[model samples]
Target: MSKVILITGGSSGIGKSVGNFLTKKGYTVFGTSRFPEKYPQSNFPIIRMDVTKPNSVTEAVASVIEKAGRLDVLINNAGVGITGPIEELPDSEIQKNFETNFFGPIRVIKAVLPVMREQQAGLIINVTSIAGYMGLPYRGIYSASKGALELLTEAFRMEISNFNIAMTNVAPGDFATNIASGRYHAPVLENSPYKQAYGNTLKLMDTHVNQGKDPLEMAKAIYKIINTPKPKVHYKVGEFMQKFSVVLKRVLPDKVYEKLLMNHYKL
Candidate 1:
């Protein structure tokens, strides 16, 4: 029997690519997004959902259960990004980001755990980012969100292993996606506290994301991990640069790492 996989934030970017790829591989793919009506009704069905909304998550899961009877895997790929000096961003902006990036995945997991626990088998893949491990300038909020996600996944992995559930966290480096352009940006001009502190740094980081790894490559990496017999707890996907970054983060002193990031982003 074909396995059933559900993906969140499947309307575009890596989520959409994974949905398309998995469906091609014969998995019964059910993707969720707030704008399901915009996604064509096809083999990879798109269901209406907002990760930050509990009701939406519940409804999406219920719909998939009714149709598929069982869900074999879940890809928690739905997330949002916000960039700027932490102090400069409005309190609401930070909360909004955490709500979408962190709590969003939690919501989906809660809605899916019951079925998986009962079946005593399932897999969850969290689409985290390198920023989850190494912090970046003007990205304190983004880092915080993913960092929390990484820790949450760890706790979840430990808690659910006994239930025969597997969890994998994919930490991809910079990818060329709409996430950079689509991020929530707050104006830096008006009397913001950290306007001057983050002005140039934000610009440089934005430029880097504008030209990064291809999103399709990320999608392929995700597909491989999903099909693994015993999926690992974490997978890092990126080019040579990303590997080097990880190494430097571990070997270099704190000041040295900071200097490298400062030079990379021209901070």
Candidate 2:
């Protein structure tokens, strides 16, 4: 029998692409959405779920088990994007972003572990971000949220290894998707000190997403990882420079890297 896969935020974007690809490859794929009804045209099943809601998470996982009898893979792809001058952004918005990006995956992971443990085999792919590797000009909150997930996976991997279940992180660089339109942008207040710089940085961030690589790249990468016998702790998918930036951060001097980022953002 083919492996059964469940992807949160599978109604659109990278999650949707991955689900479609896996389905075509003969995997029984299910995706979650807050409004599953909206995706009547989805190629795979869409489970009603809100990652931030505990009951919703449990119910979605349960629904998958009820139908599939066993779950082989879980993809934590449901996340939101937040961009703004960190100091200028409201605390509520920052917390909300973490709720979805960080806490949401944790909720789903916790829900599926028991089932995976009983089944004695499973794989989890956390959809993190390349932005998580560094604090970007106006995307500090986004970086922190995804960065937290990366760290969580590091620790969680060892804790769950005894169960024969595997966990990994997949950080993607900018991709051409509705994420730019969906992201929360703190208003550019004219009187604020960061007004000019923040506005320009916001435009740059959007342009990067608008002109970013295709989501298919991410889908193919995820499929390859799924087929691997033992997945690595972390994987990155994107253009050369985007992945290289992580390495650069590791090797470059602190102030020098800061200078490079400042110059790139024209700060």
What would the TM-scores of all predictions be?
Answer: 0.94, 0.99
Candidate 1 lDDT score relative to the true structure: 0.86
Per residue, candidate 1 scores C-alpha lDDT tens digits across 1-267 of 999999998888888888888888888999887888887754488999988788988999999999999999999999888887776689998999999999999999999999999999999999888888888778888998998999899999988889999998998887777887778876777676666757777676677677888878887887888778898878888878886787789899999899988887765
What would the per-residue lDDT of candidate 2 be over residues 1-267, giving only the tens digit for each residue?
999999999999999999999999999999999999999999999989999899999998999999999999999999999988888889999989999999999999999999999999999999999999998888999999999999999999999989999999999998998998888999999899999999999889989999999999999999999999999999999999999999999999999999999999999
Clashes of each: 0, 0
- In candidate 2, how many Å is residue 47 off? 1.0
Q: Candidate 2: which stretches are off by over 4 Å? A: none
Q: Which number leads on lDDT?
A: 2
Candidate 1 clashing pairs?
none
